[model samples]
Target: MALPSPPLFIVFNASSGGADAEQASGRVGDLLTAAGRPHEIIRVRGDEELTRATVRASHAAREAHGAVVAAGGDGTLNAVAQVVWNADQVMGVLPQGTFNYFGRTHGMPTALDDSVAALLSAREQAVTVGLLGERVFLVNASVGLYPRLLEERESAKRRFGRRRVVALLSGLGTILRGGSVLTLELSVEGQTRVVRTRTLFVGNNELQLQEIGLRHAVDVEQGRLAAITLQPVSTLRTLWLLIRGALGRLDGAEGVDSFAFDQLVVRMRRRVRWVKVALDGEVLRMPPPLVFRTAPRPLRLLLPAAEAEEGSA
Candidate 1:
């Protein structure tokens, strides 16, 4: 399970999840150096810098037949995956985020040393990703209240520091305060229906869905995506649903509806040119009707030897 012989291009985001970029880079560098594996550390800051860095790393990896490694949270991994997947180059991960859903789902280690060691003996596997229009989301994508929640969560993390408690409180605050409902025309599996809901969340990672007690995780593993929506409910009811989710009991919760689909087309009931959407963990405004489906091609992810073996078995 030796990795590609070319030098690894590591895209390290310093600000993500309060991680010390220098420390992470040093440790990763040391591991690779000790293995006599050639590598480069491309440190980046902010969304713009991350975009630029991934692109640069993708090109270098492609030319040298190396792999582009993402060393941050889900957002960083998403950014790096967008470039590396498009370029048809293999990608690796070093989970440094609060919830490394994508990494953990694929059995990528979280500790820097273990993750680096895993990568050194990793094998390539084709991984499914979601596509919102042409954009790629490795874990999940959503619109309506969910994206707004992410925005508030990011703000809270900035002010209160990045911790699970802070994130939980921020999400609770956002849900309690309430947000506008979306009137969406959803077309899935040859059926079109209009529904009013707080959010429309589509999940690609079984580990994430399973964490929330969603049965559709099995669907994702079977090469389909899972879509979830909340029926319009009072703020208190919403809070209850949140609690249910936290307890891993959301499977049959009231005011919640979920299903599996190969592709879904969504249009707002009201005429609107743009809608706020969250991909992975980053929020952006995208044009409607938003088309949610599996990427035409899968990402060639570098997985640890054990995980790779398990997948084959």
Candidate 2:
């Protein structure tokens, strides 16, 4: 017997990427309606409202096990996932962001209408999620240069507009500026190790590795995270590391270290109370020491039929 389709409630971020949220939401609604898919759209002006709206929407339509769709970028998706993770409801994505990493990682279409269609026909699957306290992240999380680069991107967006080119330039500038070195003590599998590096990156999504052309270099979905560190080095050497990491040659890259672990506790040597971290491309000031671990339960993600099969395989 064919299963009934669940109701969909979309939460749109007005300032996501560089697109007009209302027009995008309207397009999604029009397409879904024309295709006989019933849904409700809630357009939000700020990120703070996404969590509340998603939770409320999910509960209001609990009888249907309605799916809550994030109609924006990875950050917006992360916000929605925080409310829906481990719940009885499912989660969907409309990839309307600069990178659209999470959505694209799950085989979602870039075009708004196509993404909506994909969601309506998507298969449900269990996917791992990374958590820091109550917050949930679909991709990777990092401390150090990554957060600084995000901050730089925002500053550049305000100065040179929100074009991709400007964001690229801003990233280049950030890279050239270098970053602070962090001394981290990591505890994993009843063992402890200390290291110093320019950045600490923890990832749970293998799609990110593939996106960077490193599919063969790392696997992030094996019930563990691919933790990578870029050790402090000269500017030229750093660039080399970046290129090598992207090409799946990170194992031989100088000043780069990679490992896989189920749970990690990172403590800063300085014992700072708070640290700036970037999760799924969004920057936040979080208190330390940061506890990193994969949620034991997988998030129920909606993926296209083909993508679902591929993931299962």
Candidate 3:
């Protein structure tokens, strides 16, 4: 049986990845009709319409006492998240992105039927977000080769299929070849920590501790940020760890400095080259010396498998 009030808003990306958003809408509508969950499919017409439309959806969900289910990729998720963060609405994701980092980490369903089933059954949690002033991110925020590599990935996605592995290989290859590492003069837990590295990752929830070289298991929902600062012993060694980490072995590497903290401030030394940054999967060109902080219980999100697993633990 469906809840008294069904999901009132499903943010649709009709032009997402050039796939017919209407197709996704129709398919999801079929699921909703079958499951008896009430929802409205919102088609975003233009970038200019996003803010207003998002706000409108947020308001509608609140009035209907329903959830706002994001129906596209990370970029679309970020957009919908902006308006619905603090309001009385639950957030659900239907995972249709090239790399659904947040969804994959949480064990979200990939198939349409299974994904909708999870959404209809899951409990909601007030999820934390990594915030940079006005910017809010559900996953990690990073600077360096991360964002540039994403640009390359998008280009690769266009050239190859969205599911191609070579796009990842290309990004991995770029990271393996030494890119310009930067220095961050920062403070942690009221002490000074100076870091110099090419890869700086601030994970908001949990750093995906894979079978990779990174050995530390850091949890983000514990009201802290997990940070990994890396210094290459040698270019070759860095490449080895990167490959191992990609293969899920980063937690065991020696040169990787991992820690948990409430905030991080990076101090810039000079005008750096191409500071391509990322807030989740959305890429950005950022000015140096970024400040990152955690907003505790910032947004309510559907956590099906992960929350179930957490309860069992």
lDDT per residue (tens digit) for residues 233-278 in model 3: 6778877777777787676477888877777777666666545678
Predicted candidate 1 versus true structure: per-residue lDDT over 147-171, tens digit per residue: 9999999999999888889998999
Off by over 4 Å in 2: 1-4, 16-19, 213-218, 246-248
Question: lDDT, candidate 3, residue 119?
Answer: 82
**Where is model 1 poorest over a 10-residue stretch in terms of lDDT?**
15-24
* Candidate 1 accuracy as TM-score: 0.97
Q: Lowest summed-lDDT stretch of 10 residues in model 3?
A: 209-218
Question: Which scores better on lDDT, 1 or 2?
Answer: 1
Model 3 TM-score on a 0 to 1 scale: 0.86
**Could you arrange the candidates by TM-score from highest to lowest?**
1, 2, 3
Task: List ranges where model 3 is wrong by over 4 Å.
Answer: 1-3, 17-21, 45-52, 86-88, 205-207, 211-215, 232-234, 271-275, 286-288, 305-313
lDDT of each: 0.91, 0.80, 0.71
**Residue 194 error, candidate 3, Å:** 2.5
RMSD of 3: 3.2
Candidate 1 pairs with clashing backbones: none
Candidate 1 deviation (Cα RMSD): 1.7
